[model samples]
Target chain A: MTAPDPSPAHPVTGLDDVVHQRVRLGILTITHEARRVEFGYLRTQLQLTAGNLSQHVTVLETAGLVEVEKGYEGKRGRTWITLTAAGDQALAEEIGRLKQLIARVETTSTPEER
Target chain B: MTTDSVPAGADPRRLLSDVRALAHRVRLDQRLTWVALLVLAVATFVAIPFDYVGMDVRCVNGGSECQFSRDGVLYYWPAALLIAYTAIAFCYVRAARARGLGARVLPYALTGAALAVVFTTVWLLARVYLADPPTEPFPGWVMVLDRLVAPAGTIGVALLVLARLERNVALLVFTLGYLAVVLVPIDFGWTIHSSVRAEFIPQQVINGVVLLLGAAGFAIARRRQR
Candidate 1:
């Protein structure tokens, strides 16, 4: 089969379903930087409520961009989140594509429109 | 952050390097997992220092004549070991963090070890104060040590299993299977030496069987890829 078209950040990009989205992209970007963070920590950093955070996590999970692990530390249940390699690569490619588009828009624009 | 770090396009070498580094860090943690269990080992040894160093012990049963006593070396050995075990435990925790999931065996092993430590403290206390012996024999400490040691041995075997060395599996399987084969007669109380045959022989054989199972489990660990 033919390979997918190459992107600037990534050699070969996968489905655009999750990577093209805004909030999911934000979530994946933050996760890639932090090795592995707690669910509450992510929610706090994202400034999203319990419901919003949970929904975003589900979307990312479905796209295989993230892994959500929940286990008990003691009496209380704890959840940890981490970005999958696929998610990381996808994010990089998306960021590259976005920047390239912005550069094109700026360079082609009239000086007055700047 | 950018593809410029390596190349503009995908580089299998770059990806492999990153993945390999992360994998190595995780393994380092697993390798050192058992150091945590060493605490129990040290506890057992701690009892050695105080074995019979100062106190005078005696087996003064309700109406019995006499039996045992205590000494210095007995106490010193266990005490020294306890210190050593603590050092070993620190290393183990560090290693566990390195190995990632491989270190999962640590918690249970350390907990069992901690339990053994508790029993050891009780046994040593009893030896120093209550019923005593001439040589200050540790009463229930050995069993605690055994409980911890057995799991440690299992974890070691698990690591071997994790490695998935084909030869090692065959060797381990052979060794365990051989032991099970040899233990057959003894477990059934048919040892050439009458004294060798005991009620606990079955348990020993059972442990051998379990070892074989552990080896089998390791062989299958790779079936589920990361």
Candidate 2:
């Protein structure tokens, strides 16, 4: 009997495109923990330039995974980010998939590869 | 438009670890517990004057003997605690906003206030109802309740709720230490020998000192974390 290919059913195939990117994932994780986060704080925490962080945030915002609010704190304009219900579920699912992928790799690795 | 596939050579283990680390950092950074401790410490110290002013001589056992009671503390403690809880809630809100994070402090504030109210009511009822039988010993459970409802005890119990809300192990440890200070009897083995009695209440002073120390420790740790 021939072994069937497991690629189609692998955990990697289950990852969410919008949630799995490293920067976007970092943003989601931080926002989920904080409940709400400032754009500037997110940029500083993720070590991304303002423009770069803004672009990633835009993508997440467009994907309905995060919500953005523009307002003024004192006289300065500020933007705040918060995760919606879908965003929360997405982050949770993404983490679950990552864990499964890690477990699969651990179980399949040879002693020499380890 | 889905970018669902993992990038070539991306390590799942490393990604998961990074996410965990970031979440931990955010949790630690968002805590403003030191402010609450400091506010409570100041409130404790401020109550000393009220305790002194409230002291009165009361006759007991059919007027055979008399003793001093700090009646002012009965009225002042609950009010002080209410104000402290409000201040703590306000501070947490302001600090969280400044840091661009959401704070879950309303429950802690409300719980502390409710505990204060309940303890004060129990204490008042005990004073009114239990005072008549001066010669009779209080029941074991009443004695336990009395200790637990003391001003220091109330604060220590409230800190347990604060620790849980913050999800902070250090705060939990501090709460336990504060409770020990409240429950364990200690003697300094020295008293003022002056002809005039000192206005300071020793227990309140000691409780205030412990709170201030805890606040300082938390502040230092937070600074180091940054």
Candidate 3:
């Protein structure tokens, strides 16, 4: 199954999108927990394929939200992923921003629906 | 920190992680404080055999006192070594668990004052007032002991403060109290006095040796505390 691409009309901010966006956030969150994780493990976790995950990972790598190191184990190419320090910072700031957004929306909404 | 692939500007995370690492370092330091003390202690016991021959200075009051026959020697210099050993021990312990800054200061001053007072009191009694009693005016190589007195007291207090770990403070206190049994008086006091080094060695060396043992005992105690 193919995942839908983000809508073209709404472009994501690197800090807001790379680390704050749900999928990239999941990748960073997972990598932050691991000292170093393989690309396959990340793909399996986000229910993403090599190509789709690669696109998101490229965007994150460009933003310095994660670090990807490539090496080979025997004949197979191995790509490892880990959260960069910037990624950890971006995630924390994004998390704070998310909580604030949630709080603001909650305050404006009716209590019974929430 | 890894040399390569470390990203910049993670100050908040970096600070938090560094803080945890610092706390762990402090714990490891506290765990190892005893080792320095042990080395000093072993040096103390091992120094017992090098007692210098005493020069019996006849006092004005009617008693014979003991002192180092030679002016400068290994026994004379041991106090400085002991003091340095002690300072290192206290500093290590403090670095590990930074407690009682004021108490540490107070004892240091008191030890200095005590050394002066003890020296003067013993000197006056032996030299001017008493009849022909053998005694010396000061421990030999007084100039050599320029900074060691503080370390001696520091090691002593370090041992006392950490004595609960070994449960042998009672034995230590008892043994030092028995110094009168051998009675080899050096350059300072009346018929009854235990020279720091004793009749065989300079008193300064004895001070270092005793504190060295205390430091060793401290190591064992601190280890046990963990």
Candidate that scores best on TM-score: 2
Q: Write model 2 residue lDDT over B94-125, tens digit each, in one string.
A: 88888877777888899889989988888788
Per-residue lDDT over B19-61 for candidate 3, one digit per residue giving the tens place of the 0 to 100 score: 3443332233333334444554555444445333333333333
**Lowest lDDT block of 10, candidate 3 chain B:** B97-106
* Residue-by-residue lDDT tens digits, candidate 2, A36-91: 99998887788888888888899999999999999997799999999999999999
Interface RMSD list for the candidates = 11.5, 4.9, 16.8
Q: How far is A7's C-alpha from truth in model 2 (Å)?
A: 12
For residues A17-82, write the lDDT of model 1, one tens digit per residue. Answer: 555544465567556644455676556544667777788789889988899989886686777778
Q: Give the TM-scores of the predictions, in the order they appear.
A: 0.31, 0.85, 0.30
Candidate 1 Cα outliers beyond 4 Å, as residue runs? A1-17, A112-114, B1-226
Better model by DockQ: candidate 1 vs candidate 2? 2
Best-matching candidate per lDDT: 2
Every prediction: chain A TM-score: 0.78, 0.90, 0.78
lDDT of 3 at B219: 59
Could you tally the backbone clashes for each prediction? 30, 2, 29
Compose the digit string of candidate 3's lDDT tens values, residues A6-69.
7533111223644544456656665654435578766765567788788888989999888888
Worst 10 residues of 2 chain B by lDDT: B190-199
Cα error, candidate 1, residue B138 (Å) = 60
Runs of candidate 3 with Cα error greater than 4 angstroms are: A1-15, A111-114, B1-226
Off by over 4 Å in 2: A1-9, A110-114, B1-9, B60-64, B67-70, B139-141, B186-200
